[model samples]
Target: MTSRVPRRLYLTIVAGALIMSVAMGIRQSFGLVLGPGAVEWGLSLSTLALAIALHNLVWGLAQPVAGAMADRYGATPVVLVGAIALAAGLALTALLPGLWAAMLGTGVLVGIGLSCTTFGTVLTAVGRAASPERRTAMMGLASAIGSIGSATVVPLSQFMIEADGVATAVTNLAMAMLVAAPLAFAFLATDREATQAPATLTRQLSLGEALKEAAGHRGYILLTLGFFTCGFQLAFFAVHFPSYLVTCHLPVSVGAAALAVYGASNTFGSWFCGQLGTWYRPQYVLAWIYIVRGLAIVALVFLPKTELVALGFAGVLGLLGLGTVPLTSGLIARIFGTGNLGMLFGLCFLNHQIGSFMGAWAGGWLFERTGSFDPIWLATAAAGGIAALLHFPIRDEPVARPALA
Candidate 1:
């Protein structure tokens, strides 16, 4: 069974990871365009920041709907639609040249696209395909591979932007998304029986009941709240960190390289965290990630701004970066079972997106007002500390349900 599992699921896993790579990789590179695009498009930094912020907001808002659809139908259709939306959003953002177009293309459409393609939808499909025992480890493997996006795409984006221009670079990225669209079909390889196994508690519960159960569970609530910090910290950095480097007089290459390093480091961190979940309680792992993140931010804030320091900071952050994802999703699966994993993880992700919206928007808004990112940096650190506290007390055991009548 173990040997057969890899052969059977390899395509699905690769497809999921590739799709995630394109979605997240392109998403991470948005910061690279901010400085150049702002100048070329004649927009304030705050306006572009709003577009990114709106993207995150729309993504969060649409995630639950997307996840539910994936749960009810399948991941293929949802992912295919997401791929088209992602391509169209990128194309529109490239072709059109106005604020409304930017908002509609990058903010609304891309956000919707991301909701369908990213962790909640994709990982759930992957998780549902794996055996119960192997699920988390498989997810970790996929996530680690998915980190390839940041490592490769960010630098590619930077190169394209420099060689051609912002519009051309974005248009090319759109083409890449279209090229990757077919991979969504691989989701059909998933074993439907595994997902609907009779042993799962959530198999007997309605969506509404599952939501209620999660709402009543203290661990779920804590997990959701802690997730908010993850969003805030990550979004803040992804959107503003490049611009922040410029303010410090660091070259543009430093920003791209830093992001790339973060992505590379994320590969190992995600896999390591996922493996740790198999042996340790996921909640404790999550808590330490947050605590370490907080300290890292504090250190970065106080440290002198140099290319080396920025790169090192990105490496540390990357290590803790998307690691939260596998751990968080795995925790939900552990507590609730894989039956409603998509919807449950989506609900938690909503809170995370809310934090993302705040982080992205607030970073730009605060910087515009104060001409410094220090306040936001401090705030993000504080949020991490709070999230660590919240995760420490979470009960990571599976939910107990009465037998169905």
Candidate 2:
């Protein structure tokens, strides 16, 4: 029998992907802003790094709460509220630019917004919307589409900054969020329980029980540990890589292009990995992604600093980047079932955020102290190797599938 996604669920996935794109696109541009923002204030790079680091940390801390909210009340309110907060945060940051303001706006508000819109909430919504057979592929496709925002929006932000100003660019993007706000209701209508009988008829397990079980699961624990490296590496690069390139006397355009390639390549690669999730062991896929990342960084460290090499490496990195999300999340659905998928994934992603915190903060702190990014690069490469090893022991058997309705 051929597997198929219902039309309404397909629309739901599209809406979720749209929200993710907006969230990721805006988040990725934080690094781009650093180079120019430094020119504006002459502030230490560490300050910007702190704000971005705080963003990741806050996003991590809030994800579980966001996921729980989605589980209980439906994801629509959570996402709608997030979009409003994001737009407000951006507009306010433009009007009043400072360390504290950036922290409150980008760090706290945008961070909360990110938690609601990105993977945990959105992907869960998609998972619940899809049939078991089609869910994995849909997960990959959603991830791919959402990632495109990064490619398109990062450069768009760069252009706006060059032509108008950073303030103007940010404010305009804030205005754009208003257009996407209506899509949230789609998730509410096709909610996790929409296709099911009354909640009471389903097998009963309190949210507390779910949490306790996941906390104790060996595979889940290992999965969370491995994800830490992803958070660390991506956040560090997102906020610091552009500045790192500029310090090397490369043109800013190379940095922009690298991010663009990252977003673009990740779109295809994530989908490919998502499809792989159904056909192969997800743990193996996750392991390979980390291994590739580690080897790529090592190679880059030893190579010449030519723009050709930098952009080429970036394109390759982008291809490998973000393939983990579907694999990891698919693993979650496979191993534990999707009953508490949002909350469980949220917990795992919390580790990712913690890693993001370390990555962003370490990049700034290390660079400021040492005046070079070498130490952090070495650490990231090592972390990648360690993470690759961590995933190997996860038992890959499919468990009882959750009623995703």
Candidate 3:
């Protein structure tokens, strides 16, 4: 006889997926704002890039605390707060003209918003409710749905920015959060028995102590290292690909399509990778994913610089790009029990943002200083290779329960 999935599990995953898509779609569209904002404000690339960098940096640093809070309290409030922040940030961006206001709205506010509502919190809720056998698939489902927002929004933003003013585009996008906010009710509507169950945050491990545990654990180390490369590649391309296309004498629309392609493929890739994680050693699978990404980067760097080559590589890389999400989070769940999964996973996400910071800043820095992105692409390839090697040495084992203050 086949076992039926619980209603709570089904409800949580579907709601989490819908909410994450809308929030992520808004966050990812920030790239579309860079050019228009720079043109309107006469800002240098570095100024805006710095804001984006800070955005990622804040998002990364805030995650552990957010996860801890979600663990300590519940993810529902955090998710609700994030939805509100997202809408507020975007609306403020549309009304404000000053860079500081924009930074506060886009960088600081939106970053914190995403930290609360995103995969970090949503996946934590999903992981807690899911059976071990179902965890990877659920993670994949979240990743996929989140990317679906990207797939849908990027082109829409491009069209909106072109048709309406950027300000209007942002206003409408902020309003789009209206659709995402109600879903939080579903997140809150959990079975009391499940929510009342004790979580790892009852006596959360101090950051220093968690660091010590993660440092000693090979699997955690590998996961963190591999995730760094992911941030580097993702941030770099997401920020620079449009400008790079313009440099190569291609239309900006090509860049939008490329990102959308990555978004579309990621929807599927995340799901399939999730299934793969269930059947294989997620660490091994992650290692191979990084290796493949490195090789793809190398090939793209050497390929003839043309619009076709750029878009093709973008789509291919996009498929391989987010495929690692399910594997990374799934492996963490496999080795570290779900008690503090949000905090531990949030720490890993911190590494991702650090890489994102470098990626966002480095792309602009290299271009302004050297007038080319060739060097940045080369470095990304090298980073991917190193990250691939880093994963091989990780040892996946559960942490020992120690009584500590």
Candidate 4:
């Protein structure tokens, strides 16, 4: 089955996967700096959390614009701009002093960068490159391969932090983004070809029409709402889990190990979920992923905190990690078609980023006020349950489109 795929399609998939790997890998590892960053800057947890929250919010706000541009032009230019922004953001965060730099660099700049380079842009390119039958599977493959960034980068960042300091680790991350920037060119030919192909829509809808159609879609609304929990849960874990583990008096290595395990497990989880979407209802699979994830979080929070237990918890999360991306993106493609996929998916992702902002900020706020993460943990678990319910009744069938007049 794999051998039948065109070499050009394969190249697009590989390129997309590598872009995601570098972008997401570095983003996920940001938590490793929380402790040192706070100490070095003499900043409160809430202050740093606000910066991260801003990052999520900014990313959410910008995603629609980025996606629209990708839809209008091509992903190559957007991705190149994103790479430069990411590198610049990291460099600013590392070199500059005080809270403003953190806010502008890690918050606004990195967020803008991520909006262009991550899932919405990259996945849309890959989805457009494949036939509808193979789209979801290829997305899964790209996600699975992309998971390599998190697995490797998280551990490497941890090592760098331990050896040199937060500044050095972050500077190296910037360099890595610069090195990977060339991969953006890979999308040039593929995206142009995909863009020229006949759209699946009965006729091309203006951007306004597309938005109106999506607005009226009950399933799209439900899916968008459910996606909030995904961002909330993931952002919270990515930014705070390391600190949480440290709060429990575990060795720093344990936190790093657990995240590394998460990245590793996510590779399999993403691919498996992607493949599962092809066989079963993607919405239903997404519901189960959330349910299982909620249960895992509950277990980890309440259970004994041993190295083994932590690692095991991380593994469960890893399996459920970004698995949601393929399922959600694939579902949108199914409902609306891939012509406006980037923009539509970006709209859904906006809600996800809003959730991310809340989770990241609330985790720190609650922790600072109550001196415990218990409340937030329970909140996240409940949010997942709510999301699971939202996803269950989604009508995944394609929407009715008016014929071209």
**Inter-residue clash pairs, candidate 2:** 192-405
lDDT of 1 by residue, 250-331 (tens): 9878889999999999999888888988888899999999999999999999999999899999999999999899899998
Candidate 2 at 277: error in angstroms?
0.8
In candidate 3, residue 71 scores what lDDT?
Answer: 69
Which pairs, if any, clash in model 3? Answer: 218-395, 219-395
How well is each residue in 262-375 modelled by candidate 3, as lDDT tens digits?
A: 788889888888888888778777778878887888887787778788877877776777778667777787776666678888999999989998999889888999999889
Model 2 weakest 10-residue run by lDDT: 194-203
Q: By lDDT, is 2 or 4 better?
A: 4
- RMSD in angstroms, all models? 1.6, 2.7, 2.9, 1.8
Which candidate order results from sorting by lDDT in descending order?
Answer: 4, 1, 2, 3
* lDDT, model 1, position 216: 98
Regions more than 4 Å wrong, model 1 = 1-3, 194-203
> Model-by-model lDDT, in order?
0.89, 0.83, 0.79, 0.89
- Each candidate's number of clashing pairs is 0, 1, 2, 0
Backbone clashes (count) for model 3:
2
Candidate 2 lDDT, tens digit per residue, 337-394?
Answer: 6767878888899999999999988998988889999789889999999998999999
Candidate 3 root-mean-square deviation in Å: 2.9
Candidate 2 regions with alpha-carbon error over 4 angstroms: 1-5, 192-202, 398-405
What TM-score does each of the candidates earn?
A: 0.97, 0.94, 0.92, 0.97
